[model samples]
Target chain A: MDMATMNKLMECATFANCYPRDVVFRQGDPATHFYSVLSGYVRLFRQNSEGREADIRVCGPGDSFADELIFGGDTYEYHAQAADKAMLARYDINRVRNAAQADDGMLARAIAGSLAGQLQETMDCIANDRLNTAVQRVALYLLEQAEGQESPASFRLAFQKSLLAGKLGLAPEALSRAFATLKGLGVHVHGRIIEIEDMDALRAL
Target chain B: MDMATMNKLMECATFANCYPRDVVFRQGDPATHFYSVLSGYVRLFRQNSEGREADIRVCGPGDSFADELIFGGDTYEYHAQAADKAMLARYDINRVRNAAQADDGMLARAIAGSLAGQLQETMDCIANDRLNTAVQRVALYLLEQAEGQESPASFRLAFQKSLLAGKLGLAPEALSRAFATLKGLGVHVHGRIIEIEDMDALRAL
Candidate 1:
């Protein structure tokens, strides 16, 4: 986004706070606003009728959530909860819509860019689930986290192992086995911190 | 879309025809154009290195394919191929971009509407996969097809049973079993025609 559009949105946005584990919204709730994270983690997930919850993604500092649905969705499509004490910028949905309608489509285009990114990520997850083995999926997830869009050599796991397993669509035992298999390829997991000893070997999987 | 906006897009659009079993675009091809279906059916699919394919969705007359990516994607995200003889309205991507920028964000917002729709559908698919059983999925798929946004009591299966199986992430035998199981509940499939003999009973599942 350009500095101008970002400035405009920030001008109208309001700051809000949440305690750890506070639900921002649930699936099917009326979508009133979208938010940007200022501190801590926010988790987006889907819950089954029997009360099983599987994570979709976790947004940390400087990340945004539920913004892509501004143009077409009437309600929140999934659940959002604070993973920790968090600060956020909440933008009214109608104001954003009006701004998009008022502009020469630059803001709308920027929002579309954000939607495209999420859409790509979701589709890639689907492809991974359908195409890769359990061990391969784990390796890919680690590599993805360690080397995010802004590449880094090592990265700390921001959430719990149970949530990580849910994001990977693996059972807790299956995730453990996957990690055990990756040990042969020099991937190391020390509590919440992860590092790849042999990036090439991990990629080969 | 307003009549004026529709007229503007159609004014610059071109028409093309395809025979049965034609490839419109492969996954990762430069997304040069977005299209509207004038006639026939198109299938969107993803293929793995082992030459296995899974379907995403099928588009028929009065529907559109690959339109949502016009604003933000660089390449066709999935493969689109003709399932039957088809007529199409093809809009050049560059021109669409130019028009979107020239407008008062209305065109861009319209395109965003399309993106929102696809995003909602993709998320719903993820939710269905995470929450529903195989039989329940098949049942829901049947109900969805029968009760599309435009509700109808009976609907024809547009593509091959194998492709339908791929779309549902079911084995061919699993699909057959689902159909057999459905038969006990008064749902019937004969050739390509499907009718729900007991809508209330099917919905109870």
Candidate 2:
């Protein structure tokens, strides 16, 4: 972590400490504070009109959440909750923006840089969701997770299959079918761990 | 718009500007400068091995494209072409990163801010693309076009339907079908202009 970033965040926002499994902000509540996850995981979600919760994103260490209101927009589109044992740092969006506007330099760049990274990832996810086949989507998702990994033949799933399915825009059943297809292709699935027995065959499939 | 940003850009990279329809960079070419649209529009497309074009994005005024390579990565995943009479400001990724590392202010913040906005918009687009039906996607697209308008009932489609189809991840045939559906819903589509005859009906649909 960058000490300068930590100090700037401390200067710009109030840290409302939160525990694991705590509700950070509920959907429909006014988005007041932009957050940084100092430790643990934070999940963003929304309930459909039918009241079914759909996970939006799971943010981990060094990631920020509840930033839609940072643009000075009104209202919240989603709710945020801690996924596990976690600690979060909170800051007022208005104060952060004001400080950035006043200095027009380091702090401004810090926030913008963070936002930019988030934007690029979001766009990529959109592209992935547009793919037609469940298998193709799962392949793409796994490829993204395996990106930069030293060993691509095997890796741990970042989240559960159902949550992963939601992110990929597929029904959980479709995801299960996708895994079955991969298994047929000789890929091994054990809980959250995936091992490609024949890398060439898996890639070819 | 900021003089500081302009100066920073100048110090970063040199670009040979091109006319509308000119190819700025090809899909398989070595990833080079990260281009920022100074004015007009630029379209990013990927060509299959068989040489069919698939448009990824239509970047317009104040939009920055070609960022995938900046994170110590190589290879261009998409090609860029001028969509109109356009002026693109290019920045050598290394130069900008080097400069940003040394500076803690406006220049860095501007880049970060741009990135953040782009990410959020992309994520929202992805989510919508996955969750909405074709007709719903068309409706949402129209609303976005009318976002800053005095009246939300009517607006111009920024790009041709063919281009729009590519961005929306639909076949031209499917897009035409979607347009016909929209027409049935009392939304008017003529050339590049779309007018919603009944906002309530359109939303209800």
User: For residues A1-205, what per-residue lDDT tens digits would candidate 2 score against the true structure?
Assistant: 2676557667866665566668888877876788888777787766655566655677888898766456555566777887767777888887777766666366655565566567556655554455336887777667566665543378988666766777677788989999998887766789999876655554443
Clashing pairs in 1: none
TM-score of each: 0.88, 0.81
lDDT of 1 by residue, B18-95 (tens): 888899999989989988899988877788766677677667787776776776678987888888898989998888
* TM-score on B-chain, cand. 2: 0.85
Candidate 2's chain A scores what TM-score?
A: 0.82
Top candidate when judged by lDDT against the true structure:
1
Candidate maximizing TM-score: 1
Q: lDDT scores for all predictions?
A: 0.78, 0.70
lDDT tens digits, residue span A1-205, model 1: 7888888787669998999889999988999999989998888888876777766777889877788768767889789998889999999988998888777778888777676666666666666665677898888888777764322256788877776777777778999999888877776788878767767677776
Instruction: Report DockQ per prediction, comma-separated.
Output: 0.53, 0.35
DockQ for candidate 2, C-alpha atoms:
0.35
Error of 2 at A138 (Å): 1.8
